[model samples]
Structures are given as structure tokens and as C-alpha cells.
Target chain A: MSTKNSEAGEGKERAGDVIVETVARLMVPFIQLFALYVIIHGAGGPGGGFQGGVIFGASFVLLVIAFGIVNAGDRFPEGANTAFMSLGVYIYAGVGLLCIIFSLGAAQFLNYGFIPLTTHFEENRALGMDLVEIGIGITVMAVVTSIFFNLAWKREPEEGGEEE
Target chain B: MIPSLDLVLLFLIVAIAIAAITVRDLLSAIMLLCAYSFLMAVIWVEMHAVDVAFTEAAVGAGASTAFLIAALSRTTRWEKK
Candidate 1:
């Protein structure tokens, strides 16, 4: 019983301080917005899909740090994360395939100009690049979050036969 | 961009790298590595490799630090003598 009490106390401490929680709450949305901006502006700037995605993932990490992993994990369900990982890959590959198919196989894979989204070839290329960036961003964000979740997840003491 | 700033950042990075390797506590090593990554990002930017700098800051400093800490949680905090 004393051990159980101490464990509960430990859990409470891990919940983190009120200042951290408030700051995280205030900062999360801005971080996400900046992530989108990075993704969109990547073509002409330093930021891109991977960097934006990492930033997005970092926001989730911040939440986990401020509120504990279990709380953050519960909010981002594992199933959704898995779906997102696959979905991003599909979006990425699908665009490449679309270029080939729409151009009657004359264009190589990922030839964004071959995509018919816009009447102008340059516009089509730009739009396709943006889509691919978004896809990569999604995959990377899901992957980073998933890795953190798996690494940090702790089995219940009874189930794991006590860690120590 | 300034030569002095670049020298200072590089010096700090090398010091942190050595400290990370010598630190007895795994947590401190991870934090030092994070700082090293951040400084490296600054160096990349100074060299005009803004894209590489962005990636270094995001993945090297931000994501990898969190990952190392999470991995550390599943293991011991102190280095085994």
C-alpha cells in the first residue's frame, strides 16, 4: 500500500507544473501555424517538409513534456497515427504515379509538370511540389510522434514484473 | 557570419561534444548533445546553408533530443562504471 501511494505521487509529479502546462497550451497553436507556414514557404525559403514536420512533432512533444506522455498519447490515438503514416506515403507516391498516368507514361515518375492540375506547366509543378511537401510533412510528424510514444510507454508494474 | 562568432560557436560545440562524452549522467549527455546540435545549426546558417541549418535545428536539436530522453526513460540514467 505504501508503494502504491508513492507511485501515485510520482505520477502526479510527472503531470508537471502549472506554469509549464499553461505555457504549452498557449504555444501549441502558434507552433502548428508556423509549421504550416514552413511547409508552404519551403519552395522559396529555408524551411521544408521535413523541418516543418519536425516542428509540428515537437509541439506534440512539448505537450507530452508539459502534461505527461500518457495524456498526450491518449489525445493522439495510435490508430490515427498509423493511418497518417501510410496516408502521407500514399499521397507522396500517388502524385508521382499521377504524373506518369496522366502523361500517358511519357513523363517519368514525379515529373510534377506532367500533372494536369493547372493549365500552365509551371503552375502544375509548383502545386505538385507543394502537395508532396504536405504529404512528407504528415508522414514525418506521425513517425516522430509514434517513435516517442513507443519509446516512452511504460508497462504497468504488474504486467512488466516491475521495472527495477 | 562574423569570424569571431563562428569561432565562438565552434569552440562551444567542441566543448559540448567532449563534455557529452565524458559526462557520467546519461541525461546530461543528452542535453549537451542537444546544445551541440543547436550550435551546429547556427554554424550551418553562417555558412549560408540555410536549408541544412533548418533541418539541423529541427531534427538534430528538437526531435533527436526528445527521442534520446524518451529512450533514456526506459533505461537507467547513470552510466555503468
Candidate 2:
């Protein structure tokens, strides 16, 4: 359960002073809130899924830096990351598939207007963009967190090893 | 709107880059790289590329810096002579 970066060895080296930890804990919520705002407002503003997603991932990374890897894993378990990673791509492709299913007299894919949920064509397009953006955000967040974790920690080989 | 300010920032970024490569200690080099990324982000913001600036700051300066620090922790700190 105790990763090298989490327990006695490296944990002691990385753990910041109490003040830094408190500041990091207090700061993460606001950072995440701002990241969400950036994602939702991306259509009109200078923000989007990738930027917001990186910001969200950075917040957890901040937690890891200030506290340790274990705290971060505890807060957001490693198993959940795999789920989010695939689920994000699924959402993106699923939305595209949905557009094809509706077709709406169009032969093209990802035709957001063809979904026909909103009265205005622009609104439907906006909604589709939102969904796609959310998917992008999810994928970016999970991939980044996964990448950082991989770089930061050495993984234990799973049981029933298949390789020679 | 000051062209001189942009020029100054550009020079500072170049200086930081040189320092990042020249620094002997890996930890200081990583810190210098973070500083470089931040200055680069500021330059992007000055050019009105807010989205690019935002991503550069978060991913480059924020996350990558921490990742490098973690990498340093598990590895040797000094560069080979």
C-alpha cells in the first residue's frame, strides 16, 4: 500500500511544512472551480478543455507535491483513473456516433446540428461542442494525471507475470 | 503595448534558457526550466493568445515542474561532469 514516494523513504523528503500543506489544501478547491469555469466558458472565452483539464490535473499534482503521492492516490484512487481515461474517449466517440445515428438527412459525421435537441441550430451546435469539450477535458485530465504518476513512481509488476 | 517590454521579456526568456542548460545541479536546472516556461506563457499572454498561455502555464510551468521535481527525488541530483 505504501509507495516509495508515499511512505518512510521519499515521503519524508517531499512533505512540505504544515503551512505549505494547509495552503495547498485550501488552494486546490478554488483552482478546480476556476478550471470548471474555464471549461464551460470555453466556447465564448479564451479557454477550453485542454487548458482547463491541465489546470485540474495540476491541482492534484500540487496536492501530491505538498502532501505526498499517497494522499493524492487516496483522494483520487489509481483504479478510477483508468476508468476516466477510457470513459472520456468513449464519450467523445459516442457523441459522434450519436450524430450518425440521427443522420438528420446528412451523410457527414459529428454534425452537431443534426442532433435536433434545441430549437435553434446554433444552440444544438453549442450543446454538441460542450459535450465534446467535456470529453476532451476528461481525457486530458486523466491522461495527464496518469502520465505524471507513471513518471513519478516506479510500478510494481503484477502477479501472474506473462513476460519472460 | 510597449515594444520594449516585449523585447525585455524576450531577452529574459533567452537568458533563462541558457541558465537552464548551463546549471550543474539538476534541481536548479528544473527550477530554471519552470521559470522559462512561465516567462514564455507571459509572452503568449502579451500576444493575446490566452488559451495557449493558459495551457503553457498549467502544463509546462505547473505540472511539468512538479513532475521533474519528483523525477529528481528518485534519481541523482548532480549532473555528470
| All candidates: DockQ | 0.73, 0.62
The CAPRI classification for model 2 reads as: medium
lDDT value, residue A9 of candidate 2: 44
TM-score result, candidate 1 = 0.90
Q: Distance (Å) between predicted and true CA of A93, model 2?
A: 1.0
Candidate 1: residue A149 Cα off by (Å): 0.3
Error of 2 at A82 (Å): 1.1
Model 2 lDDT, full chain set: 0.82
Worst 10 residues of 2 chain B by lDDT: B66-75
Candidate lDDT (C-alpha), each: 0.88, 0.82
Task: State how far residue A152 of model 1 sits from its true place (Å).
Answer: 0.7
Q: In model 1, how large is the Cα lDDT of residue A73?
A: 67
lDDT score, residue A160, model 2? 17
Q: What is the interface RMSD of candidate 1, in Å?
A: 2.0
| Tens-place lDDT digits, model 1, residues A1-164 | 33442443323435578798899999999999999999999987889898999999999988887887556667989899999999999999999999989889596899999888879999999999999999999999999999988777664668667644
